[model samples]
Target: MSTVLQPGPARRKAARIAVLSGIASVAVALAGCGDSGTPDASQPTPEASAGPSAAAAELVVQDPWVKAADDGMTAVFGVLVNDTTADVTITSVTTDISPVELHEMAMSDGAMVMREKDGGIVVPAGGSHTLEPGGDHIMLMDIARPVQPGDEIALTLTFADGATSEFTAVAKPFAGAEESYDPSTEMDHG
Candidate 1:
């Protein structure tokens, strides 16, 4: 019988390295198996992307009415309701009737006065925000024409995310909402 030859130490070491390299190559190939360089259909499209905070919630104005005024300043009152679970902010308001400003009543110099609201009005998630007299309201200054009773005013509200919503507010007769920037004893309780 022929004598059997044993593997040298260097040859054994090279064999081990070769085996390990083969295993590593297989692992790398398996890792890249499923991805075909194609997009998955399960992923959301660009239009309907992300969570609630990614989109602005549309606000519904319920019982919207503007205080009837002839020429000068007046106010718009309503209950801004948000049906979505996301909270929204009314940053600014625009109308053809007059210049609009978001205002609130605050105590200044030991008296109650109307001032520009710091920050915008926030409508909570699945909740409501009131734009009423003597509290928080949209002030219409220097009206273009006389707003008599039964007139409808068109307004567009700009949200915090630059989204806009258009709504029509009916004019109603009201004797309240007389508070000014100066100190006034009269307060609008409406």
Candidate 2:
């Protein structure tokens, strides 16, 4: 009878398994170390990127900013670009400050007139609405802390379709707004 060699050990199989496990671990580590993708600055963040109560919309907020103010109030300026084929309406604005309102400035009686935007600002299809000083913008009022240059202001823009977009406006010292209108005409939007 031919001499048969008994199975010596499971060492070979165990070694193969160990090598596979090491490869899997290295793969996982590399995946975790990969670089995060870059984002487009023009568009608003997705729901996952933004927090709860935020949804995606066609409007893009570009170069948003809040001018520095002494203490009482300030304004956020930016351009709202609606890239959709249909018109988009921005219903309201909210911020970290106590009171925030959507405002519009226009020349009414040969003088600059500013007031709270009643219904909402409408952005035509494939058009852009500029929220600038002496124009349409978000008014941040009743702020206890003085807004200084390089500060950041958090704000949310609500739409008529129930979608909300969040953005942060950087504070900069601008001078054009001082001569735009009389500061005493500000009224309560309550």
Candidate 3:
């Protein structure tokens, strides 16, 4: 004989409420915590070394980082701010971590699908494009080395106008990403 355990209406309501409350808590935390703080002495991130390029005076990069990955693929998250009159295209990204490409994630058929992005990412004039988890992001294909917490990864970004800016992204452990994306991957912003 088998037993049928059915949840009562009250029990179901309680479960739903619990789930919603948890979600709300996380939303609040992510919103309130702000950008990943500056890198520690064990590792230094881009925020430590440089400012916006002289050529792209109006272009700014902020809160750049990659999730910790020992190997395989990973992703980078950050914000591109463009206050200039000309739209700047991120033509290419180079890093010691791995070969990188512009990628986008979208919902397809009730599941998340990721694909290579064409034409690169554009920081619109007077606006910005954000690269975050579960959205448009930088894919570091096949992380060639051990990228662990308290490590720094060098990144170089080249723009459409033949301008380039170097970045240093700190490898930090992140939670809650496995719920929306592969745990092996990566974050972003305004």
Candidate 4:
């Protein structure tokens, strides 16, 4: 009732060739594709924007990155550049991971506190706004999952004119900027 079958030498060779051919095909398909697994912090992301509008075309996020976090929340830092002769105001930020907020550090009771930015961030005409630790940043609240180093997070910035720009930011470990103004929740940065 049982059958014992073995492939012949030619059949075995053909099977090996098929497997190798599939691997080669995959390699060929992935050739020249971006995302090398390890992101280069110094270089801008190849796929920076998804669908840039007229206003978004003149805007660029340079060297964008996110702080690694196991849970809770994380922040994104980058250099927002405005190439046009008019100032660009980012009204809001949206992402798939969690709620996003434009946050800035302020002196509250002799301490630096993180709070929501009321009027959002503005990149001056032909200038740039640097989002760094303990400064202006894009805050990701209540992350659904862990954001480890080398991970990519996509975010969309809505300008005051209703134009939007999307970009992906790589995650890296950071040890600073752990203070959160909300006493009900703890922030994760390092």
Q: Which candidate has the highest lDDT of all? A: 4
- Stretches of candidate 2 off by over 4 Å are 1-56, 180-190
lDDT tens readout by residue for model 1, 60-140: 999999988777788898999987767888889999979988888887767676777868888888899898877898888
Q: Report lDDT (Cα) of residue 69, candidate 2.
A: 77
Per-model CA lDDT versus the true structure: 0.80, 0.75, 0.74, 0.82
Clashes of each: 0, 0, 0, 0
lDDT of 3 by residue, 69-98 (tens): 777777888898887666778878999758
Compare the candidates by TM-score and give the number of the best one: 1
Model 2 lDDT tens row, 1-190: 8997664569778878899999999998997666447654655556444432232365788999988877777788899987666677888888767488788876655665677888888887779989987778888767768889998888888888678888898999899746332256542231
Residues 75-119, model 4: lDDT tens digits: 899999988667788999999998898988777766666788889
Models 1 onward score TM values of: 0.67, 0.65, 0.62, 0.66
lDDT of 3 at 98: 88
User: Quick one: ranking by TM-score, best first?
Assistant: 1, 4, 2, 3
Pick out the ten consecutive residues of candidate 4 with the lowest summed lDDT. 181-190
Deviation (Å) of 104 in candidate 1: 0.6
CA-RMSD of model 1: 15.1
